[model samples]
Target chain A: MPYLPTAQSFLEQSRLLISARPTTTRITTKYTLPKTSPPDPSKSKSPPPPSSEPSQPHQPQPPKATLTLKTYDPISGTCLKYETDKAAEVGRLIAALGSCGRVMAALPAKEEAVDEGAMEVDAPVKEDAEGKAKAVPKEKELKGGQGQGQHKGGEKGGGGGGGGKKKKGKK
Target chain B: MATGHLSTDEFLIRLATLFESRRSVNHGSVFLTQKRLSPHDLPKAATDTPLPPSSPFPDLHPPHPLPILIRATNGKSKDKRKDKIKLSTVIQADELEGFFMRYADVCKAGMSGLKKRDRSGRKAKGKAKKKKGASGGGVEGEKKG
Candidate 1:
């Protein structure tokens, strides 16, 4: 199976919508009518058999609701859709998306737009507003900025940018 | 760096990549929206006609159906107006839950938490640098004596 795209790419290029379909229950009942015989002069009236009795009574079956996640890249007009009846999977996606939403909300509006090539090494040397803001902190860190060395050292493996920043601090 | 604790930009960028990767494969769980011939593509008479009542597979008809768009087999060009199509992306529940767990910590703390952590980390680095500077000065003095 192909591994999922890393989280970085998802945040940069897509918007998502989540929706739930309610469960529905189906119950069926069938009734059978009594068979009537034509009355004849020679035949005495036969006792009427019970009529309109239910022939089949089925128990109600309720199907669980399905949860759907729709992710689309507005720029490219491409979409990827996923759906599942499993509750566990639904919950996870909801939680992850919720967290992402919260973080986005907390961010400054100015940093919201990221340059397409900012993360790529060969894309271009141009830096956007967000990039310029990030550069200020790196400059301070270079001049004996705060934070533990060992802790930051351990983080070198966490992300490419983090690793590169630490190396500059050391120099 | 915490396994799931990433700054806002990093987190979002990574997520976009993850979504792109998921789109590469189409299976039971992940469905890439497909383009099928739109009703407009059919002749006027065909568009007006409904399915015959005696159709064999009644169950195949859904009460509510998803919109379909035409697929381009070769490099057929698209007509913006005539080819208007609707698209949807559906992710299976299991995968959604799996992702939630993977990024649980970051999601729980949110961006503020990361910023707080970054502040504390900076303080720690400063202290460490001071200690290193003191020890280095001592070593140089000892060598001169």
Candidate 2:
């Protein structure tokens, strides 16, 4: 049973108690934190700033060459370039020479020719006994040479004989 | 049950009926038919049951000659036989020797290619070390003096 103050007296006593404590001023200043303002809601709607610089463009690399088959045809003396796909064709040509034995014999001769200052460019042209370069005759040239003097004479004689007989018959 | 004794006549009639039923039931099955053979009706003189004459138990035949047997009997060693005989030996020694030499060359080429790759790798490493030394010249200079 201590004295209970009236509401008006309680208010006056609270004011007196608060003012009388000088230590409370430092405590209030220390504990009373500054209010944290709400995060700026306006920032959310704005787009992020673009990167300062552009990226580098990509450069394309060139394709590389791969080596395949190497062949030397003695007849042509040509160092022909046969890719991987043409290997079968090369095999077929080799087989067509009856046996590999003949091809082996011819290859050394061509190699020797190449060694003797023959240009290693196109197919090696075979040289005659006189050491002169021999040319490869075309198919038409071969046929013409084969038919030569005899064929033309025979045709002329046959035609002339037939015409003479026709003229005689008409007369 | 009463004492059941059939008279001889009744017994004979029952036996006949039993046989008749047995015959009717065994129509298609010969294995089921009962054979009637009296002891008195057996064959008179017992025929000689010929003992199956054994085959002249295959007169100890000589062993068949084999290729290996011929080779053995001929007294030639395997290596000598292989060297001595010339069966359709299509391939010549010169050609085969040449092929073997070429194959050895090819193997050498492959080994050389690998060695070249290793040497090139070492060269690259050496170049990289040289480049690093050149690039770190300032550090080397700082350490030296």
Best by lDDT: 1
lDDT of each: 0.32, 0.27
Local accuracy of candidate 1 as per-residue lDDT tens digits, A1-171: 111254333322222211111011010111111122333535647643435224433223222233333454343445444443433333234333433332222222222112222333111121221234455535433432233455467676676686467656754
Runs with alpha carbons beyond 4 Å of true place in candidate 1: A1-6, A9-113, A116-171, B1-117
**TM-scores for the candidates:** 0.21, 0.14
**How many pairs of residues in model 2 come into backbone collision?**
6
Candidate 1 on B1-109: residue-level lDDT in tens? 1122334345434544433332232111111121212234335785586545474533223233222221111111365435322222222222333333544343222
Worst 10 residues of 2 chain B by lDDT: B65-74
lDDT of 2 by residue, B22-131 (tens): 23432110010001111122244522343233544211111211000000011124776552311111122124323323322322222111112236878999789757
- Residue-level lDDT tens digits of model 2 in A68-160: 222222323322222222112222222211112212212111223222332221111222211133343344235544555567799999988
For each candidate, report its DockQ versus the true two-chain complex: 0.02, 0.00
Candidate 2: regions farther than 4 A off: A1-171, B1-96, B104-120, B135-137
Instruction: Please give the TM-score for the first chain of candidate 1.
Output: 0.28
